[model samples]
Target chain A: MSENKRTEVDQLGEFGLIERITKDVEINHKSTVKGIGDDAAVIDCGDDYMVVSTDMLLEGIHFDLSFMPLQHLGYKAIAVNVSDIAAMNALPEQVTVSIAITNRFSVEAIDMIYQGIKAACKNYNVDLVGGDTTSSRSGLVISVSVTGRVAKDKIVYRSGAKKGDILCLSGDIGGAYMGLQVLLREKKVYESNPEMQPKLDDYEYIVGRQLRPEARTDVIHDLREIGIVPTSMIDVSDGVASEIMHICKASGVGAAIYEQKLPVDQRTFDACHEFKIPSVTPGLNGGEDYELLFTIDQEDFKKVEKNPNIYFIGYIDEAESGARMVTVGDQIVPISAQGFKHF
Target chain B: MSENKRTEVDQLGEFGLIERITKDVEINHKSTVKGIGDDAAVIDCGDDYMVVSTDMLLEGIHFDLSFMPLQHLGYKAIAVNVSDIAAMNALPEQVTVSIAITNRFSVEAIDMIYQGIKAACKNYNVDLVGGDTTSSRSGLVISVSVTGRVAKDKIVYRSGAKKGDILCLSGDIGGAYMGLQVLLREKKVYESNPEMQPKLDDYEYIVGRQLRPEARTDVIHDLREIGIVPTSMIDVSDGVASEIMHICKASGVGAAIYEQKLPVDQRTFDACHEFKIPSVTPGLNGGEDYELLFTIDQEDFKKVEKNPNIYFIGYIDEAESGARMVTVGDQIVPISAQGFKHF
Candidate 1:
């Protein structure tokens, strides 16, 4: 606005631009318990707290329609927002989905997308509440906002971890990232030779991970059942390394995760080998995993110690140490974030 | 999905498509008081009801940056969503804005948008909560989700009006639409003659109406203060005729509105005359006016009778009468809906 000064968005990156934009915001309501820092915004609604989270998924930038099924895209849009609510250890109750689409889509095609949305809502036990449907000039864009509830005492934030806390991850990582790789590869092959069918039979597991990643609402429920609220929580959206950095930065503590303890599915490793990617690179930096990466206090660690689904791979340390990974070769290397780079 | 059968979206139109999509939607949560078909979804949160609404605005469809300042675009985006909250007679508490921008946008350009967002939040007494920032493949896209609270007894729906109820309209109409016409004319003129500056001085009022329309939150507040709640209410987003049809269809009644009673600003009339638009046509079907249309009981009419801001436009009648408009020449004509046709 000031004459001819132009600073490209990528120069600041997504996180930096967000910080710069929201710096001068002022909260005006007493019900707003939390604003723009956590996975979801927290609002105090008297008896319980309501947590709200939103996500916007655009075609091309977030998905390639050639390989990403419309149904899966719709389901993933809902799941992505639900995952944010799960990160706060909350129960999602309602969601609003707004979609903008080009006229290239037919009613049946849109219905297929809604079928997936309905399936996801039923799976997550959340009601589809309200939304806006409009015309778009380009590719499809789906934005979902979810509202959930948590008891006053059971809320978890990303800034609650302390020194000596245990870092935990749910299930395995890199499958979704590798799944995208497989899809992209198959797409390129199909483009060159239309006669060649996609060789997705052997890559079903990884492909499924990419097409329909589920939110960790089940883990949130399991944690509540175990009566152990995580000290800090975040979803592994941008892989393990970036998630570790977020936990470290938010809690003002450092973490040391062991590469040897990192969980990997056989199918994921196979896809990684096929793609010729480094052993730990996809596991550390590959994104869209949607797995929960949380920290639990040492005293409560015994509760989840025997849980097979939760993988304990690290410990929180002093802030000065920073975030680092202990490799299988017994080397300590600082973890770097290769977070969302859509800009 | 059914073999070769393809139903084009435009065949159903926007409203028909919405009805088709939400027809079989199942509400899975008791907390979901009301879902689609209203201004905002109502969720029961303890003693009061929490209302949520979402809107997606694309560059070419909802706005054009050439004439629409980024700051006003940001302001209008939030205002549009907030208007839905006001339509439900709720006080907005917080809002989350998700934006997708291309690299063509500078940090300063984005900051201008946020500055307007922050300004609107301050003006509307709402807090800036959470949002997503991502790179758009094409033009800018802004999706905003707003959450507001209304007392259980104070929550009004479009289906509450009864026969004999007085239809009330807030302020005026058609200014925003006329303002848009003026701007578009100016844009065309500028396109042909680049050196000619836009002649927007005389049309400032109508131009502002188009660029930055305000939601009728004041009327909601005044109604609350007066201890009078309308039986039903809706906002004029897709023309007053469409809103009348919606209220009639939902309430299962009819109405006879008077064209002589329709309120119009002086500048709006001037612009309408300049554009050669027929009298009363713009008032009936001009969209994006963001004014409240409600029906009040005759017993409570005296409460708002002295209020100059409130205009008595019509009265509810028997269901068989349908919705008709009484012309200034004393002719009766059916009010037809020219609603959102984005598809």
Candidate 2:
């Protein structure tokens, strides 16, 4: 960098910066079927397509250890990576976890973390293959990389959606975000009164959602069992509104979601009401829901119509129509969300 | 953890902790062929085996920004990961890099780092497939994961060595460690005298080894062309003695290295003299020299005998003898080195 020429990263935003940096990257191998723009990179591995996904969780950035338990943090790290693999319609077979932590942490503390990691590995049926562990000078950082395989014909990408496809969601949203708010509120209460025991019984469900989220790999299995492949799919890491926009943009189509059809659990709704937050806003714009956001052909609706877990929220439209939402009061509005901005 | 029980991480050491943590990990998938130990994890990918390796570099733990350039750091991260794949006798095809940095980094700063990453990707013929970028509360952190493939019959593990295997090394060692000493000394001189410039002209070769060490992947290609597979192999990351011991323990054999045959470049030798360090100490105990250390059967020695880059350094010994070194004075002594300890 020149002495006088420096541009702040925020000017380009995260997506824009990634686009500019990766735009010129050249692919050198034929095995690399997909690169740079999806839940995972797809590699052609003979009879099947191998998918690789990576995620990094930093202390004070992705989680606060004061409230987040070490075991839960480890489980969440694996779950998030497995979520990406599930998004590709693949079965995660192996994972590599690399962690850097300060000496302030004890071996027992690290064991607690690995106990959580081992539990997640067992739950997801993924082998803990390899990883590098080293000491850190600051907060703990955990980075996990997962590899999975899918039949070549069964692979899914975010660019496969078409007009008239039905948009679907696996489960409820906004619980993770609302759960974080409840934890923060309780933490503040305890910080002020040393003798006060935390009253967490009422917020158990939401808090559990925030602390430990299971990747929706079971949904991928269900889709395969029902013989229904999603036209396009992406795991909701950033919020529903942003994910809808991503699918629409990638597929060169548009989406119109119905607010009344949005799934919000009763606990999440009650918490949002008590917190004075708009009930629908968290589902549309909140983060870390880790649910499946996918599209399927309208003809395949019968296969999922009887399924209680999957919710039909909307439909894909023409490219020029843009991402939008139909309110409960019967009005169409364009959807724009300030997706989670870490920068 | 119990309220009254806690074990400090230092007591168990890195390897002991890893062993205890992964001891009960049961493999759930048949695709996972190897896990937890070795330079890279091996996965059965039908006709061939896919290898996965991961590494994490923390700012204050692995590097110092004051002396290490961001571009070189990026290049080194890729090189080290590639080295792990080469140790498994696989051809690296794809890599994913995840980084966390504070807002203090400029767009240009990140661009510089990517420039080096792209350059290394091009140099090594590996594709940069995908990665995650996030904000950090403290300093910069980079974690890289690489995937490679090798034929099932061609892959070599650290436990494949025989009693008569000849030990060999690719290229020189100790240059990187000496170069680091030179840089640190110059940094101190500059810190004490603002107007003084770093005298790096006389130490360019060693300094380059420090800043931009290349993975000896060409040797892997050379071995393939010569139709010879190593009995066992590992990269010299924690110095040669430590890596030799790893192979010995894993292979259930011992090694006898010749002190006179140790390779040290002229600049590294001069720097070691200036630094008041024994010439052989850095080669034995200093770190970060990414050279290949392997064992070849005696019958295959004729193939690499004419290869200038492959230096015959030692021979495999009986397990009862342990790892030993033969000095120039004709005395043999057991070799024990204090490897790089991050904690």
Candidate 3:
């Protein structure tokens, strides 16, 4: 309703936008150790802290059916919510999904969505305990809620990072974002000329990252095996720079990340260069990576440093220092979040 | 996309269409003792069967800001989901809400919604455990999931009725339906001329029924106090006739509801007459009454036989008899669902 209204969501992107909206939220529940900065919300249950997280995927906002299959959407829905639980350093046990679809979809379409749901359930060792199915006047709406458990002492929160904790990232970053670029480019090409087939075979890795990103529950198990518990943890749904800043802000600390240490997959690098987008931009702000970012005490670094899966990106620092990113040339640059702006 | 073009939902009215679409869902979860028939879905969770229920309200679909206050919308959202839990003869414990709104909604709007949610939580003695706040492209969307607890033995499903069980309604019906009528009328009057007052003062009872209908959780308490566990239970959401058919189909029994014993408030009766609508028709099929309807065993009859709040409207019978209605003048006629259709 603004008179001079030309503020498009593209201006802030996705990660930048989420930060702006969630900036003012304050957690009031003692049980809620962490809220909104992680893959899942952490709560203090009696026996163990429970991790609760929810995600809503609007049809056009979060996905495109022309390229993203229905089954994968269902799978991704559960996976994203599960990723939230994993970010809390917990194992997901149960989930509830609510979907609203138009009549344009047939029973077969629903079955396919369920097939993806069942597959995800099997893959993650979770129970599809409950959900609601209703008709949507427009496009499909999928909302999922996941619950997981972790020992009270073992639960990780975004606000627990200390000045000297080592920052660790599980798996690579920006592959999903790069994959989305590839998919969008191919779609544009196909739209321009129907006879042109998408050259997707060359971009399989990045494409798969966009289509079926996995939640890193295995990392939680591996962390336990290596006797390393993160002091603070969050999932990389909104890229590393944004997530790191989230931990810094919530924990009342600062973070400094070395750009050269960021784990970027070869395919993502190739795709980013092909698309003419700055590789660092995608690595820092492209959302939906679904990787784990955590901070561990300096002593715990020895346990996970040798693990190929864990990348040592940076370290937590005093709050007054502020969050920053060190470029490849050793110059520290202030980080800016271009979080996904769904509005 | 069907070639045989059907009328749009807006033409059918929200309630009318919802009733039509939800008519044929088959409940398959044995844990789900009851599904859409009740205010909430009932689950057989070990020592205590849990109640699970969800409600999704799209901004344009379910409410309008021109008239509906955000606080009330939040309260109604929780109340509706909680009512589903109460319908299963359970006490609600926790809830998860997922909200999607455009940037047009301020942080203050979000806070107001949370304020209402917190108020409902305190009033219902439930926990504001978890939720998701995300961006919406078009309108606001709120989806709530509630979890409630009831003893395994006390938990009731819609499919538990048997021959000779008494059919009872917890409170008067049709008030909400009439209240909606009054609000709609006022909304139209105001739309036609912006200066017109809503004139809701004289129609407080009906308007309250429409805007702030209460879930009959107290009825569950009363049943416990009198030691009268109903043979079957369901929340009156889609009206009496539709819910009765659902119970009958699920329990594989038939019922005969007496017309004379149907409870209708004086105001509701007067409103129905004023609108030239049959009073019994609205009482029979008007949805959103938020009353508890259940079947009780003959042995427990003595416990609630004299309770003024309870209305003994009918009795369950053999499946072969089919569901029917006994007219005030003694004619027995087959009962048909004339409930709200939401699709």
Across B106-183, the per-residue lDDT of candidate 1 in tens digits comes to 998998898889889989999999999988899999999999999999999999999999999997988888888889
How high is the DockQ of candidate 1? 0.89
Q: Find the 10 residues in a row with the least total lDDT in model 1 chain B.
A: B334-343
Per-residue lDDT tens digits for candidate 3, residues B1-343, read 6434455444554445444444443343344454444555554444566566777877655666666778878888888888878877788877777888777876556656767776777778766656676667677788988777788787777878999999999999988888888888888999999999988887888878877777778888899999988888888878999889988988999999999999999999989988899898879988888888899999999999999999999999999999999988999989887767542
Question: Which one wins by lDDT: 1 or 3?
Answer: 1
* lDDT, each prediction: 0.91, 0.91, 0.79
Off by over 4 Å in 3: A1-49, A190-197, A225-227, B1-50, B64-67, B103-115, B151-154, B186-202, B225-228
**DockQ for each model:** 0.89, 0.86, 0.22
Clash pairs (backbone) in predicted model 2: none
Better of 2 and 3 by lDDT: 2
Cand. 1: chain B TM-score: 0.98
The full ranking of all candidates by DockQ, starting with the best, is: 1, 2, 3
Top candidate (DockQ): 1
How does model 2 fare in lDDT? 0.91
Docking class of 3: incorrect
